[model samples]
Target: MPYKARVYVTLRASVLDPAGTAVQKAIQEQMNVEIQSVRIGKFIEIFLDSPDQTKAHQTIQQICEQFLANPVIEDFCFELDEIPRVSNLASQG
Candidate 1:
């Protein structure tokens, strides 16, 4: 079976995001609104085939830990969706 996975990577709360802070500063300067803070992140989605949900999840987590997300200054979350089987007969009929 195939599964769809979504990974969300974001800067840790304690980390300083220079880009986000600059954007917020620009907005505050132009709009004259007091902005507390701003943060930026990345989102990634992938599809994979696996026989078991547990294995799929583990694989996705490994991907995140190894390449998708930076563990030192960032945090991540993931969601998995099971792919529904498609039937050729249903399409033909």
Candidate 2:
């Protein structure tokens, strides 16, 4: 079966986010609403096929830890879903 993984990479809480702070200030001024804080992050989507769900989970974890996120400053998490197999309805016609 095939799986789709959604990954989110974020700066560690102790790390400062200048970009996010700038955006927050801009938004507060433009909208005239009080805003406490904002943090910037990355969103990544990956599609892969594996023999089983367990393998898919492991692969996604390795990919995130090794390639997608930086361990020292960035933290990462992922959500996995099995891609549904749908029949070709048009071909049936």
Candidate 3:
């Protein structure tokens, strides 16, 4: 079966997001508004074939640990969905 996974990567709360801060500053300066805070994150979608849901989750977790996210300063969350198999016979019926 084919599974779809979504990964969310975000900077740790203790870490400062320079890019987000810069954007917030720009907005404040240009738009004349005061902003409390800003946070930036990334979302990734992956599709893979697996025999079972557990294996699919393990694969995605490994991918995230190895390359998708930086464990030192970032945190990640993932969700997986199994693809529904379509049958030609069902269509005919």
Candidate 4:
């Protein structure tokens, strides 16, 4: 089975986001509404083939913890879903 993973990485709440603040100010200037705060984050996608979902889960956890997200100042979360294999490649096209 093929799995698609969606990862979301964001900075911790205690950390200051200068880029998000700048974006908020920009939005406030263009619009006539009061904006309190804005925070920027990252969205990543990973697709892989695996027979064991548990192993895939552990692999994804390791990937996120070791390579993707920073454990100190950033937090991350992900969702994994199985994608059906396409058997007919030239069915319509």
Alpha carbon lDDT of each predicted model: 0.95, 0.97, 0.96, 0.92
Tens digit of per-residue lDDT, candidate 2, span 1-93: 989999999999999999999999999999999999999999999999999999999999999999999999999999999999876996797
Report the C-alpha lDDT of model 3 over 1-93, residue by residue, as the tens digit.
Answer: 999999999999999999999999999999999999989999999999999999999999999999989999999999999999999999999
lDDT of 1: 0.95
My TM-score estimates for the predictions, one after another, are: 0.86, 0.94, 0.85, 0.90
lDDT of 1 by residue, 15-90 (tens): 9899999999999999999999889899999999999899999999999999988899999999999999999999
Error of 2 at 85 (Å): 0.8
Better of 2 and 4 by lDDT: 2
lDDT of 1 at 41: 96
Candidate 3: the clashing residue pairs are none
Q: Which candidate is the best by lDDT?
A: 2
Error of 1 at 82 (Å): 0.4
Tens digit of per-residue lDDT, candidate 4, span 21-81: 9999999999967999999989999998888788889889999999989989899999998
Which model scores highest in TM-score?
Answer: 2
Error of 3 at 22 (Å): 1.0
Worst 10-residue lDDT window, candidate 3: 33-42
User: Which parts of model 4 have CA positions greater than 4 angstroms off?
Assistant: 89-93
